[model samples]
Target: MKLLSRLVIGLVVLIVLAYAAAVGYMYFNQRALQYDPQGPITTLAETTLSGAENVAIPVDGSVVNGWYQAPAPGKPIIVYYKGNSGSFSAEHERYQQFVADGFGFVAFDYRGFPASPGSISQQGILDDAVAVFDWAAQKGFPLVIWGRSIGSGPSTYVASVRDAKALLLETPFLSAVTVAGERYPYLPVALVMQDQFPVNQWILDVAEPVLIAHGTADTVIEVTNGERLYQLVPNKDELWIVPGGNHGDLWARGIWRQAEPFFERAVATP
Candidate 1:
């Protein structure tokens, strides 16, 4: 009986040690648990286009930084919410492509990244996106929201709450909690995660046209997450699956070729 009691006690001690390790890990890597921003790229805000103008807009009690390029007088404006890593300056090529395609573009950095001030959080980012959209509307420009990877959270959230011409999501995950759960199945992510960024829940309420692109070779968030999001949207939506294309390279693989047609069609409708 004593031997059996000792074995039970040992098991309890082991479980306690494992739990302590998990807590410690979660504390140290909380930023990773939230949004892990890589080291600031030196080329983050450098503009390559001849006519591109750098601009700043206020968001959530802070000045959000971005670049603006006008392609035409009456073209729809594309407000791009970029990924977590790089600043808006690094996305000039994308803006140039859109400008060449006859669309005006605005790409902005979130708070606490580069020139933007204030702390970063899920709700803060969403509020910043809304402020940007409001700024665009005030300028009398129609808006098309583009979200990539982590940017999908605020973009989709704003799209659901506001009126937008269309939405483009690239390599988006369902939610931060879901992704964390998948990555760390042993952790109770639902309870531990501070910023949930629930895109799956918000997409269901978004009525505007949605274009989702995912690459089969994506290892970070997996293509299944994009598929799941596409399936959840209740309104007009299209999912473009790129064979062997990985995350952050959907456009490089000609996925944008398929996407541009859909974008044109959506813009032409009504």
Candidate 2:
């Protein structure tokens, strides 16, 4: 009987130690897991970003680098917040579409990515987002704020605090903690996660029209996040769940069909 008791106690101790180890790893490596800014360091000389001028905006001891292309007269501009992966140089096709539609665009690389050098945190990115919005606001054109993937955090936060004609979220999550929970159901992710980009809560404060697009087959961030955020938006615009679309294919599926019209109607004077 004593031998069995000792065996049971040993198993329990092992389980406890393993859980603690997992928690420690997640806590320490959370930033690394959440951010991947490494990709081709693109230059204006390399891509077909026609009529785009390089822009630099100073914020919090760092300069965020961006590209700005003026729209044709009497058109709105899209202040684009890129996803958590590559530099905005890779967003050429989208920019081309904007140009074709006579819509201007302002896109930038977040700090610690490519030409912009600094550390990234939730508050840090959010602050940069506001600074960028302020810069774009100077152009005197109607604005549409578009956020994709990790960009949703800053977009929702900015939308709550600033006024824009529209807010667009593509392949977004409820929050950083929520994504961690989904990815690691065994771990106490909410307690351990440090970068909690609470898009769900921030979205509740946005007063402008909001359009959320997510892929039904998006494994990076699930479709359910979009569904829940859609319900939370104060001025819900549209929720697009692309059949079998993944994280990066919404544009290929002709999202521009919905987006162009949405932009036109959003800025239309009533």
Candidate whose lDDT is highest: 2
Instruction: Give a tens-digit lDDT track for model 2, residues 1-270.
Output: 999999999999999999999889878988888898888867767767668889998898778998899888878889999999978778878887898889999998888776578988887889889999999999998899899999999998999999999998999999978988999999988877878999888988899899999999999999999999899998988998999999999999988888888888899944
Candidate 2: regions farther than 4 A off = none
In candidate 1 the C-alpha lDDT for residue 266 amounts to 68
Q: State TM-scores per candidate.
A: 0.92, 0.97
In TM-score terms, candidate 1 sits at: 0.92
In TM-score terms, which candidate is top?
2
The TM-score obtained by model 2 is: 0.97
Report, for every candidate in turn, its global Cα lDDT versus the true structure: 0.81, 0.88
* lDDT of each residue in 62-142, candidate 1, tens digit only: 688777766476568888898888576666777778888888888888886765777787777888889888887776767
User: How well does candidate 1 score on lDDT at residue 64?
Assistant: 88
Off by over 4 Å in 1: 1-4, 41-46
